[model samples]
Target: MTARRDELAAFLRAARERVRPEDVGLPALGRRRTPGLRRQEVAELAAVSIDWYVRLEQGRVGTPGSAVLDGIAAALLLSPAERVHLHLIARGEAPPQPHVPAPLSGSLRALLNGMPLLPAYVMDFRFDILACNAAASALFGPEFGHGRLSNTARMLFLEPEARETNLDWAAFSREMVGNLRVNQARHPDDPHLAELIAELRAASAEFAAWWDDQHVHERSRGTKRFRHATAGTLTVAYDMLAALDGSDQRLFVLTLADEPSERALRTLVTAHATALANAV
Candidate 1:
């Protein structure tokens, strides 16, 4: 009867309607008037009674326990983010409040500016590049420079140059999409993030496929390789540092993965600095 109940009911039904019987290793028993697995079939897969699932789907039941929700999530093949969302909604907890981005902390800026030798930047939960150092611009190219401040998710999946340069494109692309999925469920009302996600889904087939998989990543650290125009191959290990100020802003710091990469980064930054000074 309540809004939460209604939302939970809709979420469950939609999830159920997206999975085919064969998707869960069941046979295509016959053509039905509707799409997705039947209520009885889902109940079988989730180990719940048909009546119970019907009541839950119709928003006619009280808060179910964790086991029931988990079972239903698995039966529907929900992604990690969707699973968490199901629990929250079915348990009657309010969805997370929309995030209001805060200004970069002094320490985060200092970290970015001080790391002239390393490519560093600050990004919000939406993966929007908020601030970047000269080294980051130099390494990622001018698209990451001022005024552009492109979303990292957009670059890895949308930009042809990024796809060409990033040696671990497939792995990195999945991670970025997964991290964005977490935000998609967490902050459902963010227009900017919603626009970005829709854009990626419409424009990039890889993004569309990865998004449907529903993988969710809260934080990530990994080594990645890039084939730079001048530096041949550059490898870096990066970390996402959570801001200590209780904000969603994260400082991304990249370290050379090897001695050769370190030397190349130094050379790249020096040349970038010189070029900037010369144009002034």
Candidate 2:
């Protein structure tokens, strides 16, 4: 518990130091001794007394209420996941409205396989490919066949084939980094996710740059173009539908967006079916 309190204090100091006066629409009155906002400024922004804020940062205060923590989170310009993390570390409990990532069930896999025409699959907040259908395999190639990439961020940022497969590869790569940032905040204790992130940061220069920008985004619905070896160029619209059972899983569906793409995908699917039949 003492260690936890120390961590909470350290986190608050770092978060406060990450902000600037102009960032929060505050006037730069004088030169600061630190890199970020002062303790008094943060308290003023959070509507707390300077004395109390100082005490909290010093680990001298008890667990703060949700409303007060929320105020501090806003004052610090924390992302949603960061806010959740703050609550967890500060209170030593699951954050409010916690999202726990559950493994995909058989029924969920069945649902993915049911989408024979559209490429569909389920991924957790960690961007791990849990279950993908045949059409998804036909689209993304063997990466989906291997379940999740050893590291999805590495694939997006380091794999040359991925750049060719995703037409707007650079944009998608940055978006993936942002998505991972959000997930890392949500599941701070997930060691696998942490390892994957560390590997990505060390391996991919693009990933490191985007991560340092402090931008977070989750791409829910978008159109992407893929240049398939067999199918030529196919344009598809994708959607992510969250699981109704309150799990941290989302069904990713990709549908042909135009007549040309539909024809190409149909031809590709037929060839894939014939190959599977021959193999058996």
Candidate 3:
């Protein structure tokens, strides 16, 4: 658990650097001492004693209560995922675990199979692609390649050709990165996720820049435009369906809302099925 103390310290440092004084409505006031917020300032904002907060940050104290952690999270302006991570760490509930990416079950695959008109896929908590239907394959393209498309966030940021295919590349990229940021905050000890981050940092400059923004976004309903080479412009609505077992897996489905896009979607769906059939 000594290692965990170091990890907690590192996380706190990273989180602190992410927040500028100006971000929290504090004036820059001519550069002076620290790189980020002072410890006392953080304590004041969290409504805790400086010594107690310092002890927590220093890792001298183990597993703070949820209420105290909540106060700290609020003061730090953590997103939902980050806040959860903080609580987990405070409770000593984090440790590296084996991450065997689960394949979508037969029933789930069948569900996706039945939704031939919609582009759909399943992803685990770490953003690993579990399964994608034929339409999803066509929509995301085969460069997602075959078999356990590891790390959707990495692919979106590091794959240059794939990034270009996205219509609103910048916005799409930011959202992807932001979601990963939230995930990292929540599960700092997840080795697979850490490896994904390291890989993206090594591979993509665009990812590196956006990652520094410290943005967080929850997966909710959203519209995305795709510039398909064969189908022209396609606009689709995305919905995230959570799993029942408290797992971090979600089924994401994309459906066309308008006539032109709907027609394009149909064509793409047929093309996708044909491609899949030929492969089989």
lDDT of each: 0.78, 0.76, 0.71
Task: Point out where model 3 deviates above 4 Å.
Answer: 1-95, 101-103, 142-150, 275-280
Model 3, span 104-161: residue lDDT tens: 6777879877887788888877777777777777776764535434557766776666
Encode model 2's per-residue lDDT on 71-170: one tens digit a residue: 6777787787787788888877754553456778888888888878888878877676777788876767656636345345666776788887889888
- Poorest 10 consecutive residues by lDDT, candidate 1: 91-100
Per-residue lDDT tens digits for candidate 1, residues 1-280, read 4888888878877887899877776778877878898898777666567999999887777877655565576677778688678878887553344367998877778878998898999898788888999999888776684443477887777678888999999988888888887876666555456546655654577886787776887666889898998999988998988887767788889999999999998998998899999999
Q: Kindly provide the TM-score of model 2 when superposed on the true structure, using C-alpha atoms.
A: 0.63
- Which parts of model 2 have CA positions greater than 4 angstroms off? 1-101, 147-151
Candidate 1: segments with Cα more than 4 A from true spot: 1-99, 145-149
Please report how far candidate 1 places residue 223 from its true position, in Å: 0.6
TM-score head-to-head 2 vs 3, winner: 2
Candidates sorted on TM-score, descending: 1, 2, 3
